[model samples]
Target: MVVLRMTKKLPWLLVFMFGTVTASEFRSPSVAEKGPLRYVFDADKPGSDSSLTMWTAYTSKSANKAFINHGTSVSELTKLFFNESEFRLARAFPNCLVEQAGELYSPLLRTTKFKTRAKYTECSCIMGARWSCPVFEDKGRFVIRATVPLRRVEIERTDQSGVRGGAELQDVLTVQPVAKPSTDTGVTAKQSVAIRADFAEALQQSNHKNPALDFTGKIKVGGHEICTFGSEDTADQNQTDATKCLAVVGVDEGLIPHVPSVTSNVAVVSDKKASGSSYSAVPAAGGGGSGLSYFSDTSGTYANLAEDASKTVADRKTDQDTKARMWLIPFRGNDATQIEGVDTGGTMDNLRILSEQVTENPREWLADRGYKFETTSDVGLGDIDIDVGYEHLLNEKMKAEGYIGVRAPTGRGDEYWSNPYQVRRGNGQHWEARFGGTFAWQPFTWLTAKGDMYYSFALEHTEKRCAAFTGADIKNMGPQVDANVDWQYLVVRLDCNLFHPETQSLSSVFGYELLWKRKDNITFSVANMQTWLGKKYNSTTNAFATDEYALDADVAEKYTNSVGHKVRFETSLRATDYCEMFIGGSYTFAGKNLPREQDIHAGINLTY
Candidate 1:
């Protein structure tokens, strides 16, 4: 048996040695020497499948164009092509084995045949072929083998033009894998638990980290689904639906990290009463709250009048039965009792002249009463005089006072004037005397009234020439009255001159103002005026004449016969607490044919 085995292997060993010797002697052909080769697939073969079953061809003409085909078998036709041919190994044959004959050349020769066990289960077939076989008389036939992956084999073929060319093959063979099977029950359970834990942690973190996240999906816990409330519509639906119960978790600032605690608490208390409070404890008068008193006497103590009266009576009675005493007593008395029963007897003949001189030059007479005198520089023709007088207080409101001064024109005395009748060249001088008493009364808190009345005589003297050039110099005696009323936002005032003209003619003016305050810093006021001239004057006649007389005159062109109407508007702005600015304008419409005139004034006042 050893000898037979060795003998059988001898032929195979000779074949292999001969093949190696030939291969060593042969040289591969150069690529330029080999010609072109092509493989042609028989796509029409019935039930026969090849490994090159689904072949696709692409052309360089256009990207979108291609060709496809599925074949049952393929054959290489190298003899019909040019010389120096080369063949690239394409896909292998299915369900078949391939081998090359001795020393395969450039245009190689190969053969394939299907296995005996390879069966065409459906419309597929296995075939064999041979090439350059030693047993065959001519070139051998080539073969291809294939089997279907599933029940039926379907093949596709494409050409260079992307045109598909194939026929369906029904016969197929199915194969199954020989690996182990798998089960996912444990994996699915683990995945469910992991997902639930992740969702719960995400919810808890989002409540504190990011409060804006909306978690409204249904969560399954313990096999029960709980729906979360998100929107009004979802809440309403949950309320109406019996199968779903909404679960809500509200997030507040307290749930967030690092929120500070409140520092204080608010409480409500009722029926709390102050202790030891009485009506007298409040205040006797205007004691508390503003710290001002209503009945408190802010003016000092009252004076003793009885002592002053006795002193004055004794001083006057010491003078003898002289004519000067007679005049002085009546002038100093209150009424006419002493003046009517004056005894003009005794050594009083020269006394009358002396008294008359003293009355004429009242400065010397006032000097005897402890008054002082001073003079100022000449102001044009007249000198300004200042007399500060204080009286001995005899009562709370009355006093005995006297003044001594003269404000005469500069060139009026005997030295500067050649003739006293000659006119003064400048303004006139005035001689004035003043006497008054002040009284005040306050009947209630926040109410006070004070008044003062004084009799004054002002004598103005001017030479006839100066008077003609600079109006007139007449004596004007008058009493001026002023009253002020203050009531919060409303303020009123009255000022009148009882004797305005030397003829005792009275010219009075009364004005009432209404204020409308729109803001704390702005105020507006309107005022009405009722003014009348007691007597009318005519400019046409150049004398005191009525308007009717001036209108009837032959030359009435220079006269104005009508009264004027004036309207004013004022506005003020408080820029600061101590500074204010105001603008006011007035318009006056005069007689017929006269234009409406206007006057505007603006000013700013600052107080420190």
Candidate 2:
């Protein structure tokens, strides 16, 4: 799992995020000093046209009820919203018939009636009938309606009337406004609010208010207050400007990297059992000087191997960051500054066989026993890279971003790494500059596509390395291997995003990338640490050169290429509007000596 703060750390500020959005202004409401508006119903009002009155029953029932004998008591003044009260209520109370003497009645009216099991309570023993009446205006007081009492109740005990009756009641109430004799009330004219606030003042206040529903701070009486206020245009403009900044910069480290310094520049040779003592002879038969020592290699096998692995790791990390930046551009829309990241640390691990026979024939005892010093290596390498970029929305259909960054010299330039198995780790101590462009298109609500192209140019680091041995001993060394080294990198990735499950900002991506690199003036001989003597000061080369080795630069070319594909699934969490988290995992398949890998990453980002 990879976790990162959305914001970069500043020299004086230790913040995990730098973005901020002004939610709302805490303004105190001013005491009203003006009169309020007067509103009166007009003929154009909705209900004033017909004023039809309808009586409908609301019902509530249990899914299943216990059965009771006939003539069970039922309560009046009960109702239900819908017939389907947990059970198949529709089947129980089918559509009602509405007609007037063979003439179809108005569909808007509930001009029908029916009786069903008890509702308003879960008790099964009780039952009641629903009575409904339509309010169709026939322009007369006479109406066609059911005779059933509007409210009736059956009780366990009978009243003096002795008709098995309990109670029959119908109640109604009316409200009358107070008369306007001189004044309706004593305090109607004091401390009144002015509904007709100046439009300019309202607009100015809305710029500071969180105008989500009330875009205008002024109160309006247009039959109803407009919750989707008319001042939204100005409020939106202000919100947009609030997030605009002159520049945005980021410095990052690790995708929560777990890579260890598995490989060091130091090499250890032991003289244990099965040692190459048979072949390990003293210079001139103990003619003094048979000690072992280590020399630096900027183009040696282990260094190059570890360096290549590190490059692969760094490349993948950069790709992840590119995708992250590209994905966020749409989320941020046009309210963004320079979206950039300067992240460091990546992981590199490789395995190399350490067989004695692979480089040199061991001693007679070791050869007879078929014994050799062999071990597999697990090495780690890392580096830091920076990107400062800007993105622009070309149109609603497309967006583009460009960046120029540097791969800083963050790695141990020399052979400075932890050697776990006498293996090498630190790549060349070098730095490079990168230029890249990203393009994205959203063709549909569920699909998005992205493309990226990048090029890197590295500054060469020249250092002498142990070369091909001219003999088996520490003497009789060959000419110095005056090797030169340089490198350049080119890569491109194509990514497509697929819709995620109900999550609003979630997606899955499928991508393919091709990486090409050129390492000029670099090649190594078939010399192992055990087979070669140590390095000595070479006056001819004016650099450190081995006493018994010469490097070969003609066996290889300066260019190498690799291709890889990745499938990643990422999703946005339902977090606060200002804070968002994205997490994903990808599986990579590569070719041409490149290792396959799996990566899990997540990061939190904030937009002001």
Candidate 3:
């Protein structure tokens, strides 16, 4: 929602006065000191022409375009002044609803009625910007009177030079309080509170037999009233056999808040499970045979037999059954962040197949099959690639996960080719399978330590061009480890990446990161990170070189190093319930051999 506040141009103040005075008292010579001429009316005095005078008039021209100036004219004066007497009359009486030539001109009366003389002693004056007027008051009366400045007419004028001028005529309007009808005050007898309960067995038995309506009338004990409200139904579960009942107990006015009554009903069912089976059993692994041999025999025979036999017989007998059931209860406050309930039937079969094959070819296997995957790629490939990973958890603490992902070229190249090469696309498909576990140790209430480990194997297959350049099928096996310690408002974390490169020869590379967080009324975090380090045997040069040994290593080595220290700081101010302002900066300090670069970023964050 957006809120726009109108600008105020004038500082108008109000003073209120209350007194008993007749019409003649207002017209007396001594009262003239209040300024301007005064007029009063008792029941709309006959033949009275209370037309006001002694006021300066100015013409205003209004522009028809422009939203801010839509209602007022440009020629209108920025400020207006009303004499004390004129202001008083405008404040004390209802605005005149004058009609001329069948045209109605009312001073925008705010309310429908005017107050009696005895109650009309207080008055207030208001002055403000267009549409938003200010209110000034005389505080002597029991009730207050508010006056508004109203626009009467709009005009537009174009000068000789073709410049446009607009104006509007405004008048002061008065508002008064009116009386309303009194409410009826009829006494009511006191009622009583009722209580009832149905045990589990009773509820079960009621399902077998229909019970009729049962109620307990109001009863009083020791000046306290009680009423029991209930009902019971006995019939077949059908529209014709259904029953609905309700009861209400009226209580005395004084006891209304203290005593309350209740009504309830019970329904009986002729057929316990009228809708048929309430529970169903789905075999996690569906095939004709049983035991692990069923899958082993099929897989082995398929691989050994002819291609036709494998496709016709082995494929037909493979278990590919996947089904899910959801149970809904009409209750609030259920944990929906993750799926709950145990896999009570048995250990699902072919889980490893899902972890391997599905993760390996996710797009072809799970695409359009209701599974979601996400991934990040190419920290080293000079592009960003994201893939969805199929994930599931086991035993609450252990997580089984896998993903089938593809990384294509980005930018101008992305539009024409899938990968880096123009002649041959660099479309790389990668499959990752990993198992992770979390452990927590709480030595004290204010301090705790936690750790996690993930060991994964990634099989990456790129197009022929990429295979020729990389000299391998592009498969990598890696283990990731992360641990953290928290002491109330302070937290420290460590993460490491260790992987064996997937190339012609086995090579190892490792990266590490450390982060620290401190929290008070606000939050702050700092992190130091580095990555991609390894020693490689340069066959062409017949010498040992680091992973940074590119063909243009000499140029890069002149001013910058391959490895650098990345430092980042993030800070946020907790402004309110739903908003926060955060600022963060990162600097990359090149190794003793490289040039330096830094980056800065900040933005507001809102949570609903």
Candidate 4:
């Protein structure tokens, strides 16, 4: 048995010794005899690691394919980043701003087979693609590093009368990190291209530490919020109730104002209070002013001021690019059902403007009181307001401003509703004066607070007349002289900034409007207008086309005790140094049988 085992193992041992001797005695082939070889490294593979050596791949075919794939992915990702960057964003995709690879990329790749746990600016299956990347700093300088694969490079092989050059591929892979001056914003093209060039050169140099991971991208911070409320009126006087609900959201998201219409549209505020100053409102003839006019709208529906005429009063346009925030509400059929029922929303395509009618000279901007200014509103049909105010910087930590504004009856008011209940006052032109001030305090970058208060007084109307329309006399109705009425409102709001940064912020705003009113009942018949138009009272589409409706009764509704409470939360993202995007929503609890009004708006503001 021992002899047989030794004989069986003897042949295996002899074969192993012969193979070892042949390998040891054999001389290495020369470079001319054998082809050069290299292992390709890619971290995109399933098991790729931070260690460059571990990422190395065998087989030239796989390496070549990966090289081209990496190049293509990098190119495509660069293009995506360019589009999302602040400089050339023609269309914004905030929803696609940033996301994880596994969720957002698989579909784009058209296959569920590929997914990654890596985070990316947008989703894609190709590996090593990035944008809006976090800028890494070494000391005070921005460290820009790029790892690029090179097929070949040409350098001068000889300097003769006739130029000569030689091309060569890298024999080894090295790494080098480049440094650049940091901008307040993003990476420069020179930094990107130059660092990329360094990647190629470093690969030819002796092996060194792997270059810092390269990320060419940007960052943006933004969010949105919505809220809602409603109420009816009852008189409650001498109430010093300060219900404090402090919140901080953001700064004024400035916007552009709408241009005025060419039609004869007039705006006015209404004051039917028995205890306050009584003011009359008048509709202009192919004209415009601001006021309040009311009549018994028996049907309880009314027209939209925007449908009949223009609804913007750009009091904030400056000589520079108009940094103005304008409210754009679309109005369809006139009526509370159409306006507040929330079904008749249109677009801001008919953005119109009602200027201050003040001269264009810069000197005209200054009134004896202060400079002209405007604030944003979450109200319907927006406002045609003109305010003259002075702002003073009390100190580094605080500032104060005061203004007296004349709200042109030029905005969409209560009278904008369709008839039966066309008792819409705050229509036509009844100029009202408002005294208000803003006090702002910023204790630190993370915190800020502001107090805003205003009181509006109904001034006596320049003219007073009442008109009545009966069944057939809708077109030709004479005006009758009528009398005195009064109305006013007081408002106070507090705003706080909870999170504030150069590129992002959060803020909260809460306020209340207290009303003072006592108006006689206003009654009007829709039959007369329907008869004139030769259409049924329900032919709402045509009946509201014209702005020539009037009332049959001389009384206005009494809303002695009314008030509105509102809260708004807003957030902003600074996509770039000059561009900011913001969104917010608010619900107003209005008083005196008024419906709760809600508003939500979002926009991007740009500065040159």
Candidate 5:
């Protein structure tokens, strides 16, 4: 029995000497050669193929606060209304200019019903009628209060007396006319006419009284008139009343006028309709010209309606900064009642989100509509880990170990349709138990030095999470519970190794871990049941609390507590006497709330 052969010396232990090779093993050895006691198996390689570009998150511990790449938060957009002045919306229905005929006792047709103020130079469409009126420049003026939908026609009257309220049977009623733009009207004429002026009654209603004309000049575009009404002013030569002298000439120089300017025409003969002409226009007014032409005289199609009203008053003063409008409804209130939680009755009518106006920075307009942060990933079988340790050498240069494990629960969980930086493959279905210890030494002939510790426990079970409510709640938004989660953790490592001599089969270890997690006592395993918008009403158990959101304590203070600190590096090789292969990567540079992640792995261990 005098036979022993050795090779493949130490790549984290797998030494088996059998027959031949001897020369006293080339002497110079003493206590440093048998510290692996065997029984380690690994496998790995189901997920990560490493090529990441951007994705990081750490809830808090301040590395300048990481939520890295594609982050967004202004409390997730939904606020909906604040008004620090100037936010006049209006336009749910007014602006009918005509269409309502039935009862006419003529108190002026009983005060004719429909006219909230009409005056135009350009919301065009004459013979074929289609008038819209949208001109907004509020605050610095030029406000055309919109809501127009005109174009209904009918006319005729012979009258017959009836119903004891004077000749009343003329019936037909629906006249929506505001026409003038000939050439068989296909209507495409607009040369500035944004009315809403009161320059002290526009020079006492000018019809060109011309005392040397000068309703304060400006009003050109095609027919040249920086202040016309002169050349002996022929019947008030027309630039259609320069929209009431541009409301007293304020659109400086960049004159704005070309034609079609009726500026208010309220005329009524009602039994239902008949208006061959009507008048009450003041600026540049003077029309009895038979059949809709309140004012006309062209050669203008706006070369500068004051540079489009100074670019709409600098885009309405940059969209008036923030009249403050919000409606961020992640559902739960205003009837979806979680006791009216998302800022009192939220309702964007189901978030079709058509800009109820945030103007800018509503998280950059919801990150240009894609709403940012979504870089998912996933792969199979992950939370397995099944240790059964028991190594014990204690000399040849030290060694010791002890293990007990379970882990199972096959991985992957919490996938309410992903997106929350998606990337799940395990640990969420948690089932752990673990319990560890390691100690290695091998003081030299090629280094070694280890120390490890572990603890997991976690058992609870019920699963299906996602409902943080607020803590920068990364939008998983409401509903999805089962609870009873336990999550406790604690790890610790410290290693170094670097062999490679006569097939120490290439080594290299290097490590440093220290994880720590505990804060996810999440309960609701049955507490008050759970309904979320239906049964609610638990004024501290005053009756009605089958649970409409009551796992309480602000959701157990939103489960926090985290800590990390990885930094590993591997590189093994052995390849034969019981196999061994490895590949490395780890790097959670620091800790807190966790997920700094920097993966990359590759494995195979098998050393029974």
Candidate 6:
């Protein structure tokens, strides 16, 4: 598994109100608040844009899951297979005994309603063969069928010796039930019982060939094939219709050359330091504001402006403004001067506003300005991604793999954060379907290159979001309104490595990664907003009523599509047969609507 993270050490203030509400006057808090009539500050800046790259880098780390041609890990030596709970053995011939043992679980198996092996146990075979028998009692045979529940059973052909007939079998088999299995003889849905090795032979012959063989069969869903299943003839050692056994998606044994079985477990940890500066969108040249600034100020005075433009009595305004503002007294300007009708005292840093309300500064009240997350460090698990697939070694110099995965929204999403600046540990808690491929090449003894490309299709979900009045709720102290959001992401990465001759286990790896995210489409009901605003102001339901809701096209347009490119360098040391350590740093050199940030990370890889 791969993990990513970021920090939220805010350095700027954003207390502006949304839309047209005038509470109090103060300087703009961010460039997003630079112009008049633009009240809703892009509060999602810190948690969005370029900062999102950290989560995507997990795809780069997934390269480790690719299949290598050479045998190196324990998964290549020992394989694990599960049984189809309803598989059976009928017509017990005299000689054979089958034994299944292992403790393994697969998400695919769970989805198929197939029983998974939970422990190692030697159970009796239908043939009355002795338990733990090293030898057979009689020279007879039995055909395995899927008509009965053998539950959590898998057959490992301990002997590579071809059955006493003209056929061979792969080492591992997933016995799945067949419809109307024949009890009279070696027949399952009319499939011949004689062990067939065509699939296995092709798998073995394709080892050193170019354009590696394709032995996987299609797995269809809703009339579309979305994944593949191994075709290693598992029905009583006879080739079962691959399309029929969707639960047996993987036949780990014999998939990769010289690897007896395939199973891998990995753990990763990444650290991202808080950044004081971030790249931000600036008004285009000649399009308005000054040239772009690589950094944006996140702190400053904020104003809550409210207006009832059409409300008047004999051309005189009669609207009461209830917008409360937070004054940053310590950060006042140096040019302190007294106003004509208002008494301003002391230096600017120690100044005070003498209004009838005379409320204390934001610092005095624990949450007077706006709500903020606790500054203390928070640690927790991130979203969980389960990937399953197959890889084929094309030749001595290259290999390729295809896979599909699902991301579980188990981590904290935007709604869980106290403010927009706080880091959201998950991708909005939206289930995602991810598919990708990895290709690798090793042309020389000291050089290797690998590339990975993947796309994530985020499902739309309904969640609560900040619906502040005006833009005053910049600190996220607004009403929570249900919003439906949809997201999609695309990523590609390439890595080149140079190995040391003296220490083949050490290598210098350089990589470039790219990510593109489609702008999110967030939709909310205008009626919901009208109800909230009508209840609060009592007479402005008409003002809040509109065809385009506050968070509709306008707010969505502000974020646009985002793109980022990052380059990194790292040194990897294979310290032991089962362990490797790496340390690296990355710099995102260019992109739009992305944070131009740098990060350093270190982690270990353990294989068994």
Judged by TM-score, which candidate is best?
6
Candidate 1's error at 64, in angstroms? 99
lDDT of 4 by residue, 1-608 (tens): 01122344344433322221100000000010000111011111222111111010111000100011211221111111111111101011111111111111111111001000111110001001000111122111111111111111011111123321110111011112223223764422211011111111111111121111111111000110011111213121111122111011111112111222110121111111112211121121121132211111112111121111122212111100111011121212122221111111111111111111112222121111122111111122212334445545455567665767664553233332111111111333456677878677777766667676777765654223233342111111122324343456666666565554542223333333333233333333232221111212123332222223334432222222244444554555545544445554444433432223343444443322
Instruction: Please identify model 6 stretches exceeding 4 Å from their true place.
Output: 1-354, 358-377, 413-418, 468-477, 525-553
Specify the poorest-scoring 10-residue window by lDDT in model 1.
Answer: 21-30
In candidate 3, what are the lDDT values of residues 484-568, reduced to their tens digit? 2111111122222111233211111121212211211111121211111123334466544443211111111121112224344
In angstroms, how far off is 467's CA in candidate 1? 9.4
Q: lDDT at 39 for candidate 5?
A: 18
- Candidate lDDT (C-alpha), each: 0.19, 0.26, 0.19, 0.24, 0.30, 0.30
* Residue-wise C-alpha lDDT for candidate 1, range 202-286, written one tens digit per residue: 1111112210111223322222232222333221211222222211111110111110111011000001111211011011222
How would you encode candidate 5's per-residue C-alpha lDDT over 391-469 as one tens digit per residue? 4455556666676656555444345422223333444665778677777777775777778677877687776553433
Weakest ten-residue segment in model 5 by summed lDDT: 23-32
Q: Any runs in candidate 5 off by more than 4 Å, and if so which?
A: 1-391, 403-433, 445-448, 451-455, 461-482, 487-494, 497-510, 514-565, 568-587, 590-608
Instruction: List the RMSD of every prediction in angstroms.
Output: 72.0, 47.7, 43.1, 41.3, 31.4, 41.0
Evaluate residue 255 in candidate 6 and report its C-alpha lDDT on the 0 to 100 scale: 27
Once fitted onto the true fold, the runs of candidate 4 whose alpha carbons sit more than 4 angstroms away are 1-383, 411-418, 421-426, 462-486, 500-555, 589-593
| Candidate 2 deviant stretches above 4 angstroms | 1-382, 413-427, 463-483, 500-503, 523-550, 555-561, 565-569, 606-608
lDDT of 1 at 74: 16
Candidate 6, residue 379: CA error in Å? 1.5
Worst 10 contiguous positions by lDDT, candidate 6: 90-99
Kindly give the number of clashing pairs for every candidate: 28, 14, 35, 71, 8, 23
Q: Estimate each model's TM-score.
A: 0.14, 0.33, 0.16, 0.28, 0.22, 0.40
